[model samples]
Target: MTELVATTPGLLPLPDWAKGELSDLKGHQKSDLIDGTEGEAVTEAYDRVRAEELDWQTEAGLDRVVGGQARWDDNIAHPLSMADAVDTRGIVRYYDNNNFYREPVVVGELTATGDVAAELDATAEALDDGAGDLQAVLPGPYSLADLATDEQYGDEAAFLDAVADFLVDEVEQFPDVATLFLLEPSLVENPPEAGIDERAGAAIDRVATATEADVVCHTYWGAVPEKPYAHLMDADLDAVGFDFVSDHEANLYNITEYGTTDDIALGLVDGQNTRVEGVETVRERVEWVGEQIPAQSFDTTYLTANTELFYLPVNRAREKLAVLARAAAGEEEVTA
Candidate 1:
């Protein structure tokens, strides 16, 4: 029997209370010199938000929940930006969205900063004693290279290779978790140059294989082009996520023609939109995909938003999680 699981691409909108807490903390820091207490306060606020976000997912009946990446102000690039090799430069719009991140410019040879492993340990500590199966999120090699300003690595392939190797080092240190969502928006937003798709796939495979947890190479904004989709299928990923909410016709065609992994993530809900989807609506979308791909079968079908939920308000993001859980479990509405 195929298992239907509910999850997300990981980042979620910060709640109003958390925003207030951060604001107060920042104000305190501005008034005082750079002190350990100020940093601790910021971390304390993030911890609170992370725990609350996990609780939200748990309450919604999600099978595998993320820490919600509440501390990630720079979105997918945050983990790598923490490294000494990267420098924060001018702001760049994240995809076509209004969201922006301080562009991470590669200034030196890349290195694993150990931030991801520390974050994982912290997430484990934030857990409410055996309540939720933790999940981690990271920017995939392709997107990281594509999005960043490559000042260090002179060659394109070398830059991509370095980023992949850096990620592999980071992944190798990961404490076992339920899932690892490797966000690769560039595969859909801006695909690699011709004949380079296989190299990209190999890079992704290296990172995916380094971890024991199930890795989902999630692409969003639109469907991955046919050639890249074919190459992605060659990777060692457990599941390949597609944005069914945007340009899903292309996504459906790719799946039917090229086929995907035995386990797949159907991004059936709109992550950026405030309009929350209902159980039946999402279920119908899943059913439709199944109907279209009758020749192919999935061992596990993950119900998720097409992109990160940070674009929506916290309440709406929470509602989206509930809808995904409800749809997967065949529940018409949320239950007390």
Candidate 2:
């Protein structure tokens, strides 16, 4: 029988305590500081927040654990924005949402900066081996390219390939993780241009092969158009995730018509909303997907948020995680 796992796609909301701590630390800073004592204090805050986030996942009975991305202020493009080869331009609206992130623009030859690996390593050390089946998250190559402007590499395909290679180098430095979730929202938010899908899939596949961990290419905000969906299926990913909570009728149709990998993720929880869903409601969503593509067909199924949980209040995000765990465990009697 297939196993049901409850996990998040990463970028969870920060707890109130962490926010206060960060505020206090910022008060002590001089000149936009992130070095010396100021930097150390921020790192300490992040470590504490990550440890608590892991505890939240474990206490909620989630099978897979993520570090909650407590240090990410720029959302999915954080690592690339930190790279020396890249420079960020004016803030842009993140997809169709109110949230915004600095759009990364390539200025020089793209290269790995090891920033992501350092953060992951720090998180792992903070978790102290307590994060069971730990996972790491990264911005998918196609989305990274889509979200970024290419000033160095003139050709679109060349720029995408460079971004993929940069990610591969970054992934190579990561501490051993069970799974890697590549958030590729642009695939759904901004559909690939004509004849770009195959190259996009190839770039993703190249990055997937860079690490030993199982890779999941998770797209959200909307469903992938049919042509891109077919090309996405060619990527060497352990599972491909789709958002089933918002505007997802097309997602169901795509899976039923074109099929998916044996291992898959269904984003049934609304990560951006404040309203919490009951376990039964989540179960019904899973059952609905099962009706379209029988549950027996997949080896492993991940129940996750439709997108990052950072948009919601901290308490609500925690409640959502608990709800996901309950649904995955088939426990209908949920409290608050």
Candidate 3:
């Protein structure tokens, strides 16, 4: 198994040329825009931004590259929009802060137009073409079901299974891409009122079983449920990502134990906050973890606790985060 890894948390600002009318929408005041009026124009912009972000990650010395999620509205909304399986009642918060509401779009039956595969391929091609490593991000099945309206699914378990199958189908489309398939199960941190652990586990299992890509299940926003980690262990995934900013001690304990099985995508940088971490502090943290696990037992990645693109201006965020990554890698000296 390959060793020593670092990552920037997923999602980056869409370039001006890709955003289109997505910016005109009431809540998307901070989106990037594509230059042309046509749909193809919008897609081309997405492709360009994806390629650029992958390049940035590679230049920053990141081992695994994320598509930067330039093609989606928000992180969770991307898969929901693709599945067409939710009804946004125009009152839904675009993010947790209630800054903007989704304009109440109805999710129709699930369909795969192969657009996702094309998007993934375009990103993979960009990375390969540039000789950069790349990874793809997907909204997890439970997260999708949690975001969808209860009225639409009737039974969340069944709905999650269907979405998982859809995700599996999409993932299989990119077999040769030497990238980890990252599943963002943001909703798992705060499950729906009607959700059960078993059902969510089953949904995740479906995706795990169907796709051959190395999987990295990520649960951001808060602490991950123990059951999900156990479920992931049972499945065929290659690693699990956890947010350490909020509960570092607990997460560190979890990683010390189960982290042996999979590479640990340790989110040391706080995505929600703009306060940059110092090099010495970050190095000490990484060294502490290294002492617990052999260099081979677990690998670490530097990432923001959440999507830095959502909170900070892109360039500033990238600059600050690059420092944090350098700190974690022991590449730079700590200053007073």
Candidate 4:
């Protein structure tokens, strides 16, 4: 008998205590908060919380377990650890919504490989010994290019290629450790108006071909252009992630076009907002998407559009996700 698999969107929450600890560590240098917790105490706290989050996911019957991103200063810096050119700015902003602020460092060059691979290795080692569904998250090449300063890289294309090369190296090194390599292109919301560039496509292709692991390209926070979608379809990727919580109509259109060939990670859970969605609401959205493609053509995985770890209060965030889990199990209905 064939087994049916459902993915629940997961949250990345920082415990209240952890936040307090971070605050204490920041004392006078609040700006350096994001890059401040790289030492022993912070690492230990992160490990404990990450393990707890994974356990929560397992108990909730979630198909995949993210490392909870507990150790990351921010999403962008988490993957850029191997790079030598980047430096900590000691201060970070949410970049959107005029919400909470984050202390993330700026990337100095595209040629360096940050500590992403090491972080993934550590995270993989921390999960249950036989866990088969572990995933590592990364920022997309184009987005990294956009975030880099003009002083860092004279030619954006060349710099992007360098970052892509490093990504390919990282992907190839940990083929057996993770189930999926998730790439988040936050900048895709504002890509170059002309079209998808060759260098970007090539970088994605390189990583896809090098890793036996499934590659999922995720674009959230806004709409992705047709040219990039076209380019992604031609690349050697296994799936594409779309945020239903954000621009559903545009994402739906993209899914309709390429869902049959590529696996789809449906982001039903809102990552940035505090409101919890009911099962019925999520189910309706899933059902609508299911109608567009065969069940096997896509896999529904719940993910907050961005990291909930940074935005929501920890306890409230967990309670909200608890509702999502119940919904995924068909135990509750989304209230109007």
lDDT of 3 by residue, 1-336 (tens): 225455655677655545554444423322322211125545555667777777666656556667777656645556555444444445465447533434324355665545567766776667654444566667677776565564544565666776777777776775354445455545445653434565666677677666665666676666565655555556555666666666766666666665535456666666667676665666676666667656455543434344435565566556555655566456775232
Tens digits of per-residue lDDT, candidate 1, 129-167, equal: 545588888999999888788899898888899999999
| Best candidate (score: lDDT) | 1
Per-residue CA lDDT of candidate 2, range 190-301, in tens? 9888778888989899999999998889989889998888888898889999999877799988888887888889998999889998899998988787877764477888
Backbone clashes, candidate 1: 0
| Top candidate, metric TM-score | 1
* Residue pairs in collision within model 1: none
Model 4 ranges off by over 4 Å: 1-11, 26-37, 90-94, 99-114, 129-132, 150-152, 257-260, 293-309, 323-336
Candidate 2 Cα errors over 4 Å, as ranges: 23-38, 128-130
Rank order (by TM-score, best first): 1, 2, 4, 3
Better of 1 and 2 by lDDT: 1
Error of 3 at 69 (Å): 1.6
Q: Which 10 residues in a row give candidate 3 its minimum summed lDDT?
A: 29-38
Candidate ranking (lDDT, best to worst): 1, 2, 3, 4
Q: What are the per-residue Cα lDDT tens digits for candidate 4 across 1-336?
A: 122233332337677677777656546444444353355555566777877777766655455567676665555544554355555444444446554223323356444343555556766777785443777666666665555444455666666676677666666666364345445454355565343355566667776676776666766775566666666667777667777777778877766664424355666767667776666676677677676555454443443333333466655555545555555556664232
Q: How many clashes in each candidate?
A: 0, 0, 10, 19
Candidate 1: regions farther than 4 A off: 27-38
State in Å the error of residue 125, model 4.
Answer: 3.4
Error of 3 at 150 (Å): 4.4
